[model samples]
Target: MNHRMIDRNREEGHARLYRDYFSDAPTYTETHFRRRFRMRRSLFLRIEEAVTTHDNYFTQRTDVVGVRGLSSLQKVTAALRMLSYGTAGDAVDDYVRIGESTTIESLKRFVKAIVEVYGDEYLRRTNDEDVSRLLRENEQRGFPEMLGSIDCMHWKWKNCQTGWQDRSHLFEDLAESHGPKVRYTVNGYEYNMGYYLADGIYPSRTTFVKTISKPQGKKRKYFAYAQESVRKDVEEHLEFYNLDLQ
Candidate 1:
């Protein structure tokens, strides 16, 4: 699923990216050199198969070949990049003959259609079996109300229009050479619906745990350090798995 075709458009960009990575640099055979870098085909199908099959296609039935006058591979690559782009469908507009807004709308509809075929998924607490598993992992009291850990994660946003550039922040880039950006959020802590464990910096709610008290003495300091250390351990674990994806 992580494979990608090294088409002409992406070649120039990737070449510049990997310039330092390769010894000889600019001019080289991608098919031969990718083994050195271990770039595999993320996209499973060839351009021909897309044109021929897919009765279950998400879009309104159209003659993709005749109307767009483009190959299936080119179109699929452009579409996938939109998910990573902060500018949404901008690359699609450049790669295909279409309005940017139309491309964005189509991709949104495609994602929804795929997920619907899969399931209506979200962070809400489900049945008790899932609840029990989470509590045992956290060493919390059995039958806690909440789901899992309470934490914020950053999802990287790619290149934005000049005006919006300042709003985005890149996180640790991937080992696959994918750029990193982040969107932070709160997750269920302890249980599917239990209170959050937070520091003075994080906001407090009646449903969550927060440490915002004025420091009265040494006991408070000790407890704060304990929570802080545990939180760091969790983040380190997350970061470890993130590298595994690479």
Candidate 2:
């Protein structure tokens, strides 16, 4: 087996990438960066900084033969481009000057580094403060005691269990005798359990609030619309990243 060396000129790619996005006076504006990257420039830079610090593969390094490899910017940009556009790995080669194999490898490492660096805070169980924040936000949106929106991505299986349910540790606290309690009044009726806005497919569980199948009057119709609009948060977030939400 033989390998081809294309001389991607990684240094020039890094220079162009930095000048266009990371330099003090970048060629592109923050708005453009946000539109393409699916996140604010500040957030992207923060992720880049964290990943570079966490993973040495992202840092530019010289080989034993004194040949410098791709800089952190080129590697990160390549990985982000693939994620943001859902494009093929080779699609970023011309700009990022990263080979297809290298682009794929960078993406794998970037994902791993991101998980290792930020997973604890972002992926942990929701605490009291989080529940409180969600309660406040949902209350303003006409959904008192609503925890958050819930949705599922259907997948085929050989023999799956019963219909999907909230099997996470989310409801564990609610079951505890001395756990955090949420109380709210709706239409003169007081409720204790915080619920999530789900779809019709979900079971009629007290913790899962689904919209009306056929909203009758103006009030019901409005409520249905509002609930659905709020429930699509996860879908909207997935779309922003060019991911297949379903």
Candidate 3:
């Protein structure tokens, strides 16, 4: 069997990629970069630096045949394009000059590297400092002790296995069973719990501050409108909750 050799001029790919996005005078504007990459260029560069430091696979290397491999920028750009656009791995070959198999490998390694490097800070439980910051921010928005707004995404599990249940960890931290006790005041009435703004579908709980479904008076109507407007913040940010229920 003869080996199929295809010349993918990786150096030109790197040069083109740098000129299009990373050069001192890039072809694309910051707005275009953010729209395509789903993040600011600075944030993407920070992530690139972090992932390169954490994993050697992202570092461009010289092969045994004295050929230079793909740059870290090329590998990461291919991976991010797939992730941000939900496009096929082969779709990046023309732009990033990465083969389909290499693109898939880069995605797997890039995701694993990100989780390993940043999961501790980004995926951990909200700490006291986090709570304080949230409280302050929410208070400025007319919610004195609001931790955050609670919302969920619903996706059909096609071909899901039998006897499996959807278990949510969103309420793990706010569960009355093991949740921390705290005190706050609303309208001069002291309460023993912080609350999250939520919709009517959520079960009534001390931790939930759902809007009124039907308002009878002007004051109640205004209150509902104000609560709903502020609640959109969580939906926009796609924030996470780690509370538990009793």
Clashes of each: 23, 0, 10
The number of the candidate with the highest lDDT is 3
Worst 10 residues of 3 by lDDT: 155-164
Candidate 2 runs further than 4 Å off: 141-246
Pull out the clashing pairs in model 3.
171-243, 171-244, 172-243, 172-244, 173-242, 173-243, 173-244, 174-243, 174-244, 175-244
Q: Which candidate's TM-score is highest?
A: 2
Q: Write the per-residue lDDT of candidate 1 for residues 96-153, one digit (tens) a residue.
A: 4434555565556544443343233321224456445544555553223333333433
What lDDT does each candidate get?
0.39, 0.73, 0.75
Sort all candidates by lDDT, best to worst. 3, 2, 1
| Candidate 2 residue lDDT tens string, 1-246 | 598789988889988988998899999998888677766677677778889999999989999989899998888888888876678999989888899999999999997897688667664577888778878877877777777775543422111122211333443433332223688777798767678777876655667778988999998999898888888753334332311111
Q: What does the lDDT come to for candidate 3?
A: 0.75
- After superposition on all CA atoms, what RMSD does each candidate show versus the true structure? 14.0, 6.9, 7.3
Ranking of all candidate structures by their TM-score, best first:
2, 3, 1
- For candidate 2, report its TM-score: 0.64
| Tens digit per residue, CA lDDT, model 3, 74-124 | 999999888766688889798788899999999999988977987775756
